[model samples]
Target: MKKIIILLLAVVAFSFKTKAQTFHVPENYTLKEKADYGKYEDDVIKGIDWLQDTPWPLEEQKRMETNVFLMKWIQGSPTVSIEINGSVAKMTEKNPQLLMTFMGGYTKYALQNKTAFDKNKANQAGVKAVIDKYVVETDHKNNSLLNKLTKIDKDGKLADWMTSDFNKTK
Candidate 1:
């Protein structure tokens, strides 16, 4: 009985250690970790697609579908490099701070079949268009919150407000 109890305790302790390791995100993980995260996100996208494609197991499908939609809204670092034509377009290399917010917003808007901004309804729009729509809306309504962060002074200097806000997040 003593040996059995000891073995069970050992197993439980091992499982706890493993679970902790699985969820660990180091403060300064290497570039390889970024690539791995991107791969996992790709897998999530594919899994969502597969779940949607299946015909049977309707309840399980519905559950996974819901979970996947929520997962899509998560703001993650830009690990996935998009390819335009044959060339790799690395947004993270250029602007790491703004990548997550912009990408997440564009992704949610694009994938949700939401209506285009009210210029011309007949044309489908991409990320640039979506960002333009956001900027235009902000301009038209003079969105105070966004303006506070993004506004430029008369001398073309950036607002001091967004300097700290955009600097340390990454």
Candidate 2:
């Protein structure tokens, strides 16, 4: 009976350890390297997985850095943008607030870096679709992120993009 109790305790401890795991970017990693394209995609997926499994970072700087890293990755590749859209859709049920936080970050990043983001129309459309689905499927009226986004996009360009036929054909 003592041995069985010990075994159960060990299993519980192991589960806690696994659940506490968080993803961290590798040291010296560069997002600009042409040869590290595969690694970039893997890191972005891992980051999303981390967001789903772990609580968000407590530090403001850490959160902003994470957002910037993800935005850069999304901007750099259409493949990665598609992957993010699918993953975010899946995340809606499990962690919708996190998805909202991510969308808010992406929106802010795009507005601040218009030149870089404007060149990636496909990625922008994909992100817009994800946001549109999120808004429709979730109670977004009270969501602070969505509220802030509406204010930031004063010219309605982002709204226009979200309602475009691009998502309809998807």
Candidate 3:
């Protein structure tokens, strides 16, 4: 009886220790631990492409850079590729994550210098058109997708000051 009780206690302690081994996720994934998570960024890029292909007014790089949410990615230094509707006609060499960065950088560069192709024209023009189309579609249909975006500007008034809701009493 004494030997059995001691053995049971030892098993319980060992089980507790096994269960206490906590998982360790990498820092880039969580910024809390230091584990080598390897390359997971490719999936992120693929996911962005998924977002881009969807009908969310995914404009060309040019216009997206100006938007603050998208701008954050650009400022971070990811490369951008511009596909017209679906064909791969141009790219920014930085990676898709920096589409806005490339867009913003290219726009700034064009403003300072004059080049004909390789993003001089298509990047800026494509981004602007896509963004404009997105905004119009969002407004005309009363889209919730851009509702957060609509409230971003400081004036708030500029987003759509002339709307009927703007003058509502409530």
Candidate 4:
């Protein structure tokens, strides 16, 4: 009986291991044509604007991860079970902090992972074009944020500056 139980456990474990899910980046998302290029550029600008409004002591890395999942979810099948890359990825997706996590992360995602998330990369979908420009703009804003962050010495000071900057701009 013990041997049989062990065999059953092994089978279950094997099945779980074999079923471990993997990320399916849609086939070769690349930019093509005048319209696509224009939209992509616009999206990039939008992404940069979003980042400028993000709170200081910027969590750019965290934001990037969230963007990757959002892009994947949107590009992949919406009805399909969104295979979030990790527990954090799942949390970021469902996270209520849209301003910080979702928006900021999306901007990061758009800027950094443009090639992977391009509308033309896979099935030649039209939707992806909307945000392509946003992501591209993010690249510039991302660099700006990094440059500003590097210049600052203290976290508290950075946070204060970011808040002040947002208020001033707003």
Best by TM-score: 2
Backbone clashes for every candidate come to: 0, 0, 6, 11
Worst 10 residues of 2 by lDDT: 78-87
- Report the CA-based lDDT of candidate 2 relative to the real structure: 0.50
Model 1 CA deviation exceeding 4 Å by range:
1-33, 55-57, 65-74, 77-170
Better TM-score candidate (1, 3): 3
Please write out the lDDT profile of model 2 over residues 35-73, one tens digit for every residue: 565566556655544443334434445555666676676
On lDDT, the candidate that comes out on top is: 2
lDDT of each: 0.35, 0.50, 0.36, 0.36
lDDT of 4 by residue, 1-170 (tens): 99999999999877644432222222344444434433344443343334334332355553464345444433442221222222223222332232233333344344455557642222111112222322334333333333343344224354444334422421
Question: What TM-score against the true fold does each predicted structure earn?
Answer: 0.22, 0.39, 0.24, 0.23
Measured over all alpha carbons after superposition, the RMSD of each candidate to the real structure, in angstroms, is 19.3, 12.1, 20.5, 17.5
lDDT of 3: 0.36
After the best TM-score superposition of candidate 2, give how far the Cα of residue 133 lies from its true spot, in angstroms: 14
The order of the candidates by TM-score, greatest first, is 2, 3, 4, 1
For candidate 2, the per-residue lDDT at 147 reads 43
lDDT of model 1 at residue 43?
37
Which residue pairs collide, candidate 3? Answer: 27-31, 60-127, 74-101, 78-98, 79-94, 79-95
lDDT (Cα, 0-100) at 110 in candidate 1? 40
Model 1, 10-126: lDDT tens per residue?
Answer: 999787445433421223323344454544443344333332232223345444443444244233435222212100022223322223324333343343443443211111122
Show model 2 residue runs off by greater than 4 Å: 1-17, 57-61, 82-170
